[model samples]
Target: MSPTPQERRAARHQFGTGSDTPAARRGPSGGRKKPITVDAIVDTAFGIVEREGYEALTMRRVANALETGPSSLYAHVVNKEDLDELLIGRLCAEIDLPEPDPACWRQQIVSVCTQLRDQYLRYPGISQAAFAAAPSSVDTLRVGEGLLAILIAGGIEPQPAAWAVDSLSLYVNAYSLEVSLANRRISGSDDNWVVSRGELLRRFAALPETFPHTKRHAAELTAGTVRDRFDFTIGLLIDGLPGARRQP
Candidate 1:
């Protein structure tokens, strides 16, 4: 006769050893065996980063969460870098790029950058993977390809179109990563976190005769909302684009 569901689970537990018996193999408080898969491991890794931050993510922790040996994780993923890449690829899958529009290519590029920032912000540990991911995976490349097509449609020359995709992606990734890192440093506390007006007052008080010019414009240094800063940077780059003056 075929093994019962309980027997099958026991054998799976036995495959790794130690916790092989039905009683030992019982789930947390004898609940149930959590199913395992590549996605399961990835999801668990995401949870680890979410709860403890990216620095705490490790194969051992993931194994502990799933009640399995770390060796089992290697059968599906190669190494920490590979797991990080997989996580980033999964995160990139969330962004939805607009179709190339010649009439509004500039706006389309900025819109895609905004979406990219939103995705990274939503997934806390994502920017860590992005640090070394310049070439990008299939999902990221699709967005780049779409942006390139949009630039080409706007009459940008082929060489500039190619460079623009890389340059714009770099700008967005670097800027967003910087902001995400800063936000992470602020304790997730409403009361303890720095208030804008108070922050300005502190800066104003710190300036002295040694830094007269800095004191004068301290308020301007930390003035705008993040959206305002993002718009300013993107606007500066758009204004400098070679094809900016081309007829639509």
Candidate 2:
């Protein structure tokens, strides 16, 4: 059965709020085993993600990390989907949203995106969960609400502001996922397929006449640090917003 609104609220309060549930005074095995709470589950999941990447995260893996069984995880988390939402919610809760300043709204949005990017990159492919997580997660909604407030304060109409938030979120997720995949490829043993910028340039330059423009503009294509490209793309998105104020 689906959880009621009140049940959902209680669950969010129990899991999403960062507070840990109390450990039992004793264990069933007559040994001192740490209680398995939502916090412990999330912490264990993050450890798995950090050490082995998000692809390695699973109920069984988290259970093993907690020295418990997968069935034990169901007591706190609903399933893999629920756990994904919790992970994203936890990351969103870490974002520090600023007060809306019309003169600085653009920079504020950029800062939010940068914060989310850093968070996603930290877990390496965990943004995949963000893509699938339900939008109703309270912590995720908090970040969206913060972004909407900033955009509206900057003179954006309600509809465009809402859509802008979605676009910005999609871009951040896609960008972070790409970077994570690239990093994984570069770090793997069969990384010969992942070439340095110089090698990329050489490949572009070596292409036949069929790719004239790509060959001619190889340097420009390969230019800029990842951050430079990140800032550039975000700037483009922010500047394109109707009625976006440009500060001197």
Candidate 3:
């Protein structure tokens, strides 16, 4: 007789097939298995990224996880680049963008940045995927539209608001990637990073003849947590905004 549902589930689990669902597919043996869908492809891709860093994410890997061939994925995701754009869209589209609040533009901007950062942080190396993606996706456009509305409502000129959004988005993505890379490379021991950071600062300070500015503010420069530094930078960006043209 055929294997019971429980036995089939055990077989799927024993293989590399993911969660028990209709999406599960059987091998050449002709049994109940999940059908591959775009959603399933995306889910499998994320799982691979989480288990192994982004570098290990490939079509074959995801396909293998689904008990299917990589060609099966092509019907959904065209290639690695296409998959990346979809991945970014998948994450970005979920952000709950706030309606433009002229009176609270600054706060809104901060909240948006924080949300985007947290979203990307969940995937560890998602920034790499973001870097490779185009801005054509629905999700990416939504984010841009939301930020633009907020900036425009703040009495900012169109051009500078556009520039600000571009620059600010770039900074947040770049900063998130930098932090993610550091976390992956550093040991769990905080002492190592602390000592290494201090040593680098001291080295700069000792170079007074060659780097006067470095020597002058080493202590001050080293005085903040990562969040403090990020907040200070965000504050600077905010203060410089409301960049409308002055009346001649």
| Clashing residue pair totals per candidate (backbone < 3 A) | 0, 0, 6
Residues 1-248 of candidate 2: C-alpha lDDT, one tens digit per residue: 54433464466755555343443322375257767777888899999999899999989888777877777677667689888888998999999999999989888999999999999999999999978455786799899999999999888889999999998999999999999988998899866867899999989988999999999999999999888999999988888889877777
Kindly give the stretch of ten consecutive residues in candidate 3 with the minimal lDDT sum. 12-21
Instruction: Tell me the spans in candidate 2 whose CA falls farther than 4 Å from its real position.
Output: 1-10, 13-31
Model 1: lDDT to the true structure: 0.68
**Which lDDT value does model 2 have at 165?**
92
The lDDT per prediction is 0.68, 0.84, 0.72
Q: For model 3, which pairs clash? A: 23-34, 23-35, 24-33, 24-34, 25-33, 25-34
Q: What lDDT is reached at residue 2 by model 1? A: 35
Q: After superposition, how far is residue 222 of candidate 3 from its true place, in Å?
A: 1.8
Q: Who wins the lDDT comparison?
A: 2
TM-score of 2: 0.90
Question: How high is each candidate's TM-score?
Answer: 0.75, 0.90, 0.80
Residue-wise C-alpha lDDT for candidate 3, range 5-52, written one tens digit per residue:
344334433442223333334468426565777678888888887666
